[model samples]
Target chain A: MLGAFFTGSAIVERQRLGLAARATLLLLCSGLSLVDSLHQANGSLDVLGRLSVLVAIAILAVVAGAAWPQSVWVPVAEAASVAVLVMANAGPHQPLLPYLLAPALEAGLIAGVRGAVATAGAAAAMFLAASPFEIRKGQSLTYSSTASEWVLLALATGLLAAWARRLGVRTAGSNEAYPAAYRLMTQLRTVSRHLSGGLDALSLAHIVLQQLRDRTGFDRAAVFVPGPEGELVVLAGEGNVPDWDTSLASDGLMAEVWSQQRGAARQSGFSGTKGLVSMALPLTIGARTVGVVALERRFKWEMEDDIDSLTSILDEAALRIETALLFSEIRTIATAEERRRLAREIHDGIAQELAFLGYVLDDLAARSEQEDMQGELRDLRAQVTRVVGDLRLSIFELRSEVQGQTGLGAALSDYVRSIGAASAMTVHLVLDETPNRLPVEAEAELLRIAQESVTNARKHSGAQNLWVTCRINPPAARLTIEDDGTGLGTGRDDSYGIQIMRERADRLGATLSISTRPEGGTKVDVALQARPVEIASDQGAGRDQ
Target chain B: MTTVILVDDHELIRQGLRRAFERDADFEVVGEAGTATEALRLIGELQPGVAIVDIRLPDANGLDLVKRLRAGSEKMGIVVLTMYSGDEHLFGALEAGASAFVSKDAPAEDIVAAARHAAVSPRAFTASDLAEAMKRRLEPTGPRLSPREREVLAMLAQGLGVAAIAKQLFISESTTKTHISKIYEKLGATNRAQALMSALRLGLIRQDPSPDRP
Candidate 1:
């Protein structure tokens, strides 16, 4: 019973018991058996004599099988030797019958149920075959009952080992699945991070254009959405079409595609254009067409397959594009709402109170009778008026924005003009803008950077003249604010305005450089490069054709 | 003396303005209203020569109220007084037919002058910065062109053919054509004459000195 407990624990405690530990366990069991036999024989060599040799051989065979645990033949050989030892002492007490179960358990652990059953069957057969011989040798008449008990013990140990093997297999399988699950979780985390970063609509539109070009191999393509007056205005485009119309008329092919909600292809001569085949496809979300993709290729070919594939890609991306568009609209609205709220708060609270204070000063100035006292009151009233003027400018700045129908150039012109009017410095503005505008988000950022630079110059730089120049081409722009003021002084490298300008530039992927010009002024220049969207090769190929 | 009715949501502002007007014998504050509705009623009953209105009212936009008062009586002087001094607000008040637009930050003397101007000529619009703003707006602001494109535009405006312009600029004919097309695209025109017209109109390129041009 003790040996059984030790062997069972060794199998359960360790997933794969080491060969040395198994040898130790088996030798310990053999020693206990030898001691038992010696005690039963009164220190005589009678029963212990045969049992000692068989126990020694049994331990050797079990250790050998443990050494070669992966080999099926080893377990079978171990089982045969143990079965022979069991039959040698099988008559009445059946001391070695329990030892036969060891090989069966080892075989079960090594090869699962099949090996266990085979070893158990061989042991049972040897026991039955040797039982009649033991009975003939006048051993005992109760040998049949002992033989049945030995076979039942062997079968039970085999099933237990088989059960342990199934548990081990399940654990191994789970161990293999852990990395796969971890990888999937990491991907989900990355995707969620991007989603939370606020996907803007322009980037989505660019992506749509990119995917369209990659799939259809169009020479030129443009994305058009309905303008305020219901005309199709280009939101984004790629490649070189010299006659690329920024806005399409209501009766144009692109507009027809948008209104009819179907894609159509036309030969070049149909539109009275040369060497270009045009295709217009509606970008629809559900039943509503949100925009149109206008494509032009150099040569005419069968477009059925191209149209089908383009439609599928657009269909797959429509929901994400719409969501991004809606999100941007909401963000714009929220920003405007917050700005309006701030403007209202300032106007209603501090502005009103300050105005009231100015009025009070006016009344005080008028009420004072003494000339000297009245003069002091008038100076105080002038100071109040100055503060009120500053407050009014602040309120105007809060309310100013690059809203609909007001491009960045107009907004900046208005702001700079106001600053000039309010300040003592002379402000010069030169606006050179392309008809094509930047993405709304980029324009907004550029406007903010311009505003910060101008405000910094106005507040800090004791300059007499401020020159603001804005030059814009589609996908590229440059804004320079140069002031004939004191250059950036010492210990002002990390000013808050510069930090905000840098951050805004970083967000727009633009470059901002602030330096003191040799002509005795500080100059701030911000430049934005065209996006790297794989258009040069396509344009080159088209022109070559 | 010119009678004045104050239409402001803040009582302190009205009180101060009343005191300022009391010092001057030419103006008399007949009534004050804190809301647009009350202001309209008071203006109807009092018939003051000038109605000083704040752009932001609790009940209605001060510009809309100015429009209503203008519609009712064409000769009634309406002076818009508010904290907002943006060009949009100035223009909004101007389009709404306010006679004078003054920011709240202006001294009481300026407000009195604007009211006097409104009373004298109610049809004329006046603001302190109106002339400066108009000058800034009238300055040429249009689509930017490259130096090369400007040269090409000048040549095109001078009635030079594409080949002649190409030879003069020392660039390939194809390059010159590309530049011309880019100029056309930028100007939103189709032909050389249209492009030149757009350029001349936008001050991109000046009209040449021709004897018969004038």
Candidate 2:
């Protein structure tokens, strides 16, 4: 009865599971005890003993039945109820010595080996206490035989208890870990599906950030890519924190993780951060650290679980980013190759035929010495010249793909000189070539920007002289095209030239400024503050060989 | 008479070039081939004094054909005739040892003159228009000379003597002479007149708009 009271209190406090096993043991013991007392009442049993036994059984049943499962006191209550039933039925007719094993058996079933051993010891002590009364009736041999059976029962039940405990431990471990493993598998499938869809680099970064947020629910998440001269800059970020410093300093937390190429965590008060605990993970591709991922949130003990899984998820995400980058680069090369093919076709087909037509006309005009025929031939030749000019311009546009034999500076110099020959305007090109050229994509973008500016100046600005300048200073580069002609008027930015230039500049992470010069001209300038440094991978470079 | 073999993929273009050469009594059309292989065989068999080759042959690039023909015989005049007037093709033909270059769209007189020049001189004989294009290409769109060197070249074009230029620039005569020599080296000229002509062609110095004194 006392064990049942303690078990009920523990269940209410802890709210553990497994309530049914403990409740059944208490109920069976209490009901059997009640019947024993009732049967003994008609005999020479005193009224006070029978009433006390009945009361204890009722209380124990009520308490144990109301208890929750998996409590420390559950087996205690079950053992106590068994002791009461055995004691109440202690007589030769019912042979309560056989009932002495009940407490240990119930304890073994309910709480395993330890509870079974303790309950059996208590049952044995009670059997001894009631043995003298039974001995006076000359039942000592029956008592000794039943006491030996009780010890055997305890041993058998102890083995069953140990077997059950092992099964429970395995079940508990699977219950906790299986669902988490399944979730990680599902997340990996979603990432691979997105990768196969051929997402661009920026879109890929956004999707990875969204997935990280959904999986870990960190307060803030950001990806930092390596910039020129070992600098790290935020490529993408998501969270309550708005407008984070785009570039992380060399001494910052993310930089430390990036440099070491490992994961690290910080608890509050590191460089103005407060309340939130932050962890930085290095985003590695092959053996090199390409970037870093930083996440932060308000401190919590449960965040340790979040940290463990977030590292792996971000590692997978880094691989996706590299794949997306490579896909974009391949697409660029394919487009350039297609453009070169188109240019060659135009050069070899229509342009060649037209030049032959001019020769035939020249030969016919020379055969006829008539003055009127000479004038007609002159008119025809002028028309042919105009057509050839337009075709050459088309060829130039198509051949804008930067060939590997020349850098952007030499290509631009060649193009401007060709234009200068045909145009009344004198185009000047000034280039300060860097020791190492900008990346291929970046160089292509700058070339387009310069091309658009020059074409716009030729067609719309009516510029007599255009100056094109390109200068590179390590992590920064600037390109300027200024024409000495009519200034830019209001609402001129809506033109396709300006819109395309702005879009290309955005791709390069450059600032493009178009303004009318005070001396009467339009000047288009593009400045890139931080450029992506090309990592020199020996294996990648060796693939060509 | 200069013996000429016409090589063009288009039959009509070859007929037109043959007719253009017939008008001149000093020139004779010996043979014609429409493909690079046939042209090479005819050039080897007929051994014409000059060959007018179109840049876009049916089988190979005219520049490559020029390179091959020049390798076989240095005396045969190889005049590159092409529709494309770009400097890439022009310089490519000249660099490949062609004796002359003439665009297909140019006047028949220009080709005749190029052929005559090729047969007689056998030196690089760029057509007048092509020569002008080559000069324009040589004109540095970027600053090829230092500011001081440009100033010296401009003074030299203005008929200033070396001592007079030194006095005007407040520099020693030796420094002025050094600037002049650098300017000559960059302009690829040997004398004052050639240097002035190059400077004028490049727009580094404006042409004097007034009439010249005799």
Best by DockQ: 1
CAPRI classification of candidate 2: incorrect
- Name the candidate that leads on lDDT: 1
What DockQ would candidate 2 receive versus the native complex? 0.10
Give candidate 1's total backbone clashes: 1
Tens-place lDDT per residue, model 2, A1-545, is: 22344445543432222334334534544455456657765543443454455346445643563553543254445444444444454443332333334334445545677766766666566556766665535667865566657656755664565466556545545563566557745665565466533334555666666666555445566666654333444455554222232234425567677767778777742222456567777778656677777766554324556556766777777877765666557667887898879888977778767766776777677777899998899789767756766576667766865555455676777677767765567888778653334545566778878888887787677799999998853335699999998878664643877888897887666799999998999999999654221232223223323
Off by over 4 Å in 1: A1-197, A201-315, A369-380, A489-499, A532-545, B67-78, B88-99, B116-126, B137-214
Clashes in each model (backbone N, CA, C under 3 Å)? Answer: 1, 3
TM-score (chain B) for candidate 1 is 0.73
Chain B TM-score, candidates in order: 0.73, 0.64
> What does DockQ give for each predicted structure?
0.19, 0.10
